[model samples]
Target: MRVQPLIAVEDIERSRRWYQRLFDCVGVHGAGDYEQLMMPGDDTFFLQLHLWEVHGHPNLEPAFVRPGHGVLLWFEVEEFDEAVTRARDMDAWIVQEPHVNARANHLECWLHDPDGYTVVLASPFGDVE
Candidate 1:
């Protein structure tokens, strides 16, 4: 089974562009209350963007009105430094600058998305040795 992560945002289009730039991916199901984003030449979507207060999902809005309280969306990127560069170019809110993560033994950059989610981009596991 594969795990597909979806986050609720205030503006789908804005978040779509932000994530697309961050991962250099595309929004297959673009511009709506919900969107499916996938990597280039990939069949499955890597992430999903859903508008809050819609979709009728339980605890989606008023039930749990937190943008990204306790969750962290982490992705392993092959081009770790380039990804960090893109994030910086986008003027993204950087939670932490790029650094070697001792626990994971890889490079990582922590950032905040448009919706206040903590998005962590890391190099492939064990890349640093």
Candidate 2:
């Protein structure tokens, strides 16, 4: 089974570019009120971007813009370093610099997407060392 997480953004195209660059993914669903992004060649669950209040999804309204109140959109990236660099190049809001998580024994960087969602890019266990 695959898990696909969707977020409501202000601009579908803008968020699409930001995410595609950071994750090195593609916008398989193209630009619309909603979009789905997938890894390079894989086509399974990855992520989804929906325009705010477009489809009337529960809890996806302008009042709910501050999404990172408690949750995190976590992802494990194989090329952790490159991903971090890509994020920096895009001037993405970095909440925490890249660092090794002793507990997880890997690397991780915390950042926020265009819509203010707390996004995490983590390396595979033991991949850092």
Candidate 3:
């Protein structure tokens, strides 16, 4: 079975551009405010970007409510350091620095995308050592 991530974005266009540059993703399919990104991987991995409005959520007003927060997504990279460096250079919000998570057996880091969704970058221990 394959797993796909459905990410909520405040603005689909802005998020699309950000992810496109960050992950080198190409458009696989899309219509209007919804799109699927073809990430570089052997499996049928896809990143789905959808607007909050599509979910029947009211348009965010400055005083209405704050956007949600938490770990919204995770990604595995072959080169952990290179990926972290690229993300840092792009001014991505570095929520967590890259380090080996001994318990998890992975080298990982965390960053937030334009919409405040946590994006994790990790590499398996086997790949790192």
Candidate 4:
């Protein structure tokens, strides 16, 4: 049983670059305006970025152009600072600074992808100060 995330986007190329840099992911498969990314880790799931315009999925039309609602995706890391630094270096929009969640036992930072989906950069508790 594997769970994968299918994210609708306006531009596949741009989203590809962002995911590649942020998650160190590589293109596993692609066709036209859609691509599947395989990040370094267990191979149970892959990230799918699809161009909404090409697919003609009505729900994705306006939202892809101006995103709203949804939890989006969360990319967990073992090192919070390194992840945050890489995101910053790429000029990715940081929605929130790193903070500890004592209840959740993690340190996390939030950012919005090109399409405005929230991506969390998190590490287990005590991993970062």
Candidate 5:
């Protein structure tokens, strides 16, 4: 079985560029209003980004505009420091700076995406100083 998470974004292009700044990957499919991003070494799941309005339903209103209220799109990365640096360079909203989490056994840095989605960047304990 495979699991893919689809996120509704306000602007597809804006969100696409935002994600590209932080990740070194490409969209495997879709265009314009939707795209699926694929991480080279990680195949467990793919992230699908879509516009707030469903395609072919021009008159329909969006069901969810305010995303990530209680959701966290967490990513376990090997390049923890690089990730943090990129996030800062991209001017991403820093929810939490890099800090050790004893309970989680890792160091974490939380950030907000262009659409206000909470993204957690983390590395295993002792992975980086």
Candidate 6:
């Protein structure tokens, strides 16, 4: 089974650009208000972004009032340090700094998207000291 995460954002364009820069992902499909983002070498979309206010719901502000209160968007990267540098350069909100995850046998860092969505960037633990 393939899992595709859909994120609701206040600004679609901003989120789209942020995701593209942060993950090195691409928007394979989308026109306005919505976009399906695919990771490198992946046929199916790994994530999707939609505007909070859809077209159908006229005069409706938003279907849900809360955004990313208890959710995490996890991702694994091959070039851990490079990815971290990119994130840092973008000035993305750092939820957690890079550290070794002994339990998971990997190194991980946490960040937040423009819309306050939690994202974890991890790489397999290697002898890099």
Deviation in angstroms for 83 in model 6? Answer: 0.9
After TM-score superposition, the amount by which residue 1's alpha carbon in candidate 4 deviates from its true location, in angstroms, is 1.7
Error of 1 at 22 (Å): 0.8
Residue-wise lDDT of candidate 2 within 36-64, one digit each (tens)? 99887695848888887876788777753
lDDT of each: 0.89, 0.87, 0.73, 0.80, 0.81, 0.84
Cα miss at 1, model 6 (Å)? Answer: 1.1
**CA RMSD of each candidate after superposition:** 1.3, 1.5, 3.4, 2.6, 3.2, 3.2
Better of 1 and 5 by TM-score: 1
lDDT of 6 at 28: 81
Better of 1 and 4 by TM-score: 1
Judged by whole-model lDDT over C-alpha atoms, candidate 2 comes out at: 0.87
Better of 3 and 6 by TM-score: 6
Q: After superposition, which runs of candidate 1 have C-alpha atoms over 4 Å from their true positions? A: 63-65
Greater-TM-score candidate between 1 and 3: 1
Candidate 2 residue pairs in backbone clash = none
lDDT of 3: 0.73
lDDT by residue (1-129, candidate 5, tens digit) is: 766877888888788788878877666665888888888676643788888767655523565446766789988888888989999998899999999887777889999999889999999656644
- Which regions of candidate 5 deviate over 4 angstroms? 41-45, 56-65, 125-129
Model 1 worst lDDT window (10 residues): 58-67
- lDDT winner between 5 and 6, please give it: 6
Backbone clashes in model 1, listed as residue pairs: none
Candidate 1 residue 124 Cα shift, in angstroms, is: 1.0
lDDT of 1 by residue, 2-108 (tens): 89988888899999999999889998985679999999899899888998889688656753545788999999999998999999999999989999998889999
Best by TM-score: 1
TM-score for each of the candidates: 0.94, 0.92, 0.78, 0.84, 0.84, 0.85
Stretches > 4 Å off in candidate 3: 40-45, 55-70
